[model samples]
Target: MSDLNTSRRTIVKGAAWAVPAISVAAAAPSLAASPEPTPDIDLSTSTPGAAGVVRQTDTQMNISATTFRNTGTVPAEGLVVTFAVDSGQTIEGIQVFGSDIKNVAQGATTSGYGTNTVTLTLAPGTGLGQVTIAPGSEYTSPVGQDILLGQAGAFNLTVTVQASNATANSVGYMPAPQAIPA
Candidate 1:
């Protein structure tokens, strides 16, 4: 019984010393390795009066044309334009604020011939609407406004030139952003 008591006392004393030593070693590494805390970086005022741009409310499609018809009088390449608006606004029709249709050629075939394609890309924003190519007297039939250009990253409109050997051309437009009534 005395021997067991002495053994227990020795074990308790050993453990008491070992506990503090183990704790000191474990904590020492972290305490010595850590450096002073870093100061936080201030991102405020990154751009003073940076609110000068319009807030993007809806997504928009930017239109562009490529490879238009090569009629007898080379019909000029039609222009493609872009417009934007806030969400839920109805797009009645697109207006051509500007245009440049000047291409002259003397060929054997029609004016609006060959496969002319128009491409539209969606710029980063919110809402979207339908796009169509309105018809003209000598132009091909209007491509309907069935094109729901939502967040479709980008879309292409392929126009087969008119069978008419006479001078002809095709241009597409997107509706203007209407003002929301008070």
Candidate 2:
């Protein structure tokens, strides 16, 4: 009788562990098959009045009131803006404004003001908030104050926008000859 009772206890212990293992194996497939949501983003600038320029000096200028639009199905969050300029030019300052953006933060600079590329992002924190571009909405930025120290007759500017779940959007702008002073 004693040997029989010990064998019964061993069987009960083994079965208890086996039941949980079987349940976990049954759940694995469903979790692995779930898909990620997609957000499609589009960007564009206003025509005939895209940007306003003010020449601070022969080598310094401020570009303001550049408008942008978002025509996606979902809100675009975690926005990152990249500015590319010609050689001998540098972006000095940038300011972004939108209904969904509570604050703006400067991103990590690889070469500070010396490099031709500058990047900025929506500020992230408890109260600082972030920039979220809602579908069918519009946003504007004073854009940047740039220095054309290269003394080149004309400089090209390109802006690119990116988000956490959406593909990147980009647009190019060249100040009209009449817009810039000689």
Candidate 3:
């Protein structure tokens, strides 16, 4: 009887250890699987304003171009680029030029004059069909497309680019410590 009891205890202990080992082995395949590649997008913008200043009367700043480059191993799909401005400032107009872009949407504030953010999205398609930017390729906005600003104060301008398959990247332009004066 004592021998039988000892055999049962040994089996129970061995089973307990085997369960954890089996679980670890089961997880090995998933751990060995490769993760999805992330797309690396770079954003570059031409200088804004003259001497980093925009007159309140003019209320306009012409940015030569805003460029997006894909430096990753994967393609950037369903790309959406958003332009935002600081408080006391408004985004008047932003012309986005891209072959894959479907449309541009601008959001209005309570004042109902100009917007604070402009979003650009890609057309409906897949892979190469709706190519936002392929690896090592780049897209640039058209020249003479003025980025209009409003109000009489200093503000910061930020541009964020996001893709369906990759993380987003942002770049900001604040002319001076006080930012671009309007």
| RMSD in Å for all candidates | 21.2, 11.5, 8.2
Estimate TM-scores for all models: 0.19, 0.49, 0.49
Instruction: Report the C-alpha lDDT of model 3 over 33-90, residue by residue, as the tens digit.
Output: 7975543643333243333323424566555454556666656555554667777678
TM-score of 1: 0.19
- Which prediction has more favorable lDDT, 1 or 2? 2
In order of listing, the candidates' clash counts read: 7, 0, 0
lDDT of 2 at 116: 66
Candidate 1 off by > 4 Å: 1-8, 31-45, 48-51, 54-182
Question: Residue 85, candidate 1: how far off, in angstroms?
Answer: 9.3
Least accurate stretch of 10 residues (summed lDDT) in model 1? Answer: 100-109
- Candidate 1 per-residue C-alpha lDDT over 43-155 given as tens digits, one digit per residue, 9 for 90 to 100: 11112122221212232222222222222222222322233323333222221222111111111112221112222222211222112222221222121122122332222
Error of 2 at 133 (Å): 1.3
Give the total clashing residue pairs for model 1: 7
Clashing pairs in 3: none
Give, for candidate 2, the lowest lDDT window spanning 10 residues: 100-109
Cα-based lDDT at residue 124, candidate 3: 24
